[model samples]
Target: MSRLEENILRGLNLIGYNGPLLQKTQLPVAIEGGPKNVEYTQLVNFLTNEIRTLLAIDEEVNAVTSPEDSVAFVMEITSFLKELNCPYTALTDGLVSDRLQNVSDRLLLLDYLITELMGARILQEKKPEKKIELKLQETPEGADMRLILQTLRFPKPPPNISITTLFQKLCPTIPIVLNKAGADIVGEGIFKGFLSEKQWEILGGIQKDLYHEYKIREGNVIDTIGRYHTIFSDRTKGKNELFEKIYHDKRKLLKVEPEIDMADLIAARTDLAIIEKTSNSSVRKNTRSQLQKVIIGQVPDRGGRTSEIAPPSPRNAPMATTVLWWRKRRIYTWGREYGWRSSIQRWL
Candidate 1:
């Protein structure tokens, strides 16, 4: 393909457009004052020239010297122009008014962006370039003269890293794995509307930096909980003050009976209400007796302030009733001791 066609294909690739370009579709190209339907190759050819002339881009040199550069230039221009009114555009005059508005609309953002794309080395060809360092080579035969092309290598961008690769860097010897979807979710900071900027930064740092097997400690757990909405620390050290407020609110809620569920109780009568009625004295008496048993049974629970336990039984403590067997020996020993004491007291 010619340089123009090659550059056009490259542009298509860069934009991720898989649609047909070679087909003779209504491309809508150059007309009397502007653009309309034209052949695919013709459309691109016209577009290439119009962009070059309009943007003052030198297609012969630094701007579009190579197909790769041409593609990058074309892609950037197309994307930028798609937002503005074009000179040879087939779009309606109304669209032109809405987008381009006038002639100056063509230069919308081309000024600064053109300069950035011009010398972008990553967009250059991947193949090594040949540069001649010396005109002659020192050979076995005194000096051998030859045209030289030495391969000059430039560093390429690193390949995309996956979560597995990141995990390997973070924990080399461990068998732990991270949930890719969860990692992405947490990294995005959109889920639960909770994760903080610092939390996302810390997570991204772990992906890039080598880290040992780590756990969330008190100090850092607070940071995690503060930054992340999901990973909660019940005992956060106040980094997540909002959650701490929530924790307190939840504790307060536990003490409050649900008002919504109790709404139906407006029509309900209490046992005390029924017991106080004069004609329902039998039920009242039974209820009183039952209430006494319930109160007695609940004594071990200390009125529900603490957990329940079996009430202590007197029958369970056999040693409390067993006595007097050792009293006879105690009395005999006391008598013998007192016999000596009586004689000693008389001398005193």
Candidate 2:
């Protein structure tokens, strides 16, 4: 056997093919380097069977009785390979027309295609398995506990037990109690008979204590809400007063029109114009000499002696009189002016 036939047999064994081994005699022999007249009947049949098994193809492999049948088989295999995304391109028309003539050449082509298909199968097998997630269902006991917790958190008012009991107790012969009511009436009667007068009195006392506590909590909550409202109202009032004081100070300093908005005045910084106007008015009032005296009187002599200051100019007589009146008062005049000293002494 040729090396190509040996390799094909080995490949078939590796791929778990436990059939008869392929021999050179089964394949068509080439005569004098010319094309063989015989079709690749045995070779095509074996290939078709192996392809069907490896690819899990459900279609039956047709018998290759003639060249036309072999061509059709090759086309079918090509279609399968394309669908599987197999990259083997050795099974072309040139393989059938030229290489398929010789036994060794046919075996070589088959070896290549078979090796590729085996590789594809191996890769498919080595892929990671898919994982499945399962959700756990709640049991009946868990569901009942959940329901009980929900009922406790948001309990509904009890039904009218007095009316229900009155009917059942006084009118036991009534059809509603005899037929319509089930085990509930019996259970209620058993529960009432089970407790004594002392037990009932104790339960009543507990209920009254709970109600008293609830009322106290409700009152405390109401008082807290009212106190918070009062505090918030006072804070809001204080904030408004502070804003008004700031607006008043800005108005006095800028001397802007009373109707002018505070936002516009501050944004335009029109206070510079008011300062210039005041400076010009002071100049017109001839207060420069009075200003000079105030500065000179505030400054001490370097030789520990009072400087003999010049008298006010006659032209600045009115300004000088106003300045002299200010100089006669002490710096602690604010307490007398506002009467805060007297108020403090009275409080003490």
Q: Which candidate ranks first by lDDT, i.e. highest?
A: 2
Q: What are the models' TM-scores? A: 0.16, 0.30
lDDT at residue 88 of model 2 (Cα atoms): 42
Alpha carbon lDDT of each predicted model: 0.39, 0.52
- Cα deviation of 78 in candidate 2 (Å)? 3.4
Candidate 1 similarity to native, TM-score: 0.16
Give a tens-digit lDDT track for model 1, residues 226-277.
4655343344455667866776665544422223221122223233243355
Q: Residues 1-348, candidate 2: write the lDDT tens digits.
A: 666666766776677654434444543242122222233334444565666666676544354555555555555555554554555455443454443445554565567656766866786689677789898899965575456436334343235645455335434444344366674443322122244789767766765665566667766765564454333333357576675666566445532123323223222433335455546876667755654553355666466434656666789888988887675454336556786766544543
* Candidate 2: residue 268 Cα off by (Å): 78
Model 2 error, position 59 (Å) = 9.8
RMSD value for candidate 1: 31.0
What is the total number of backbone clashes in candidate 1? 5
TM accuracy, model 2: 0.30
Best by TM-score: 2
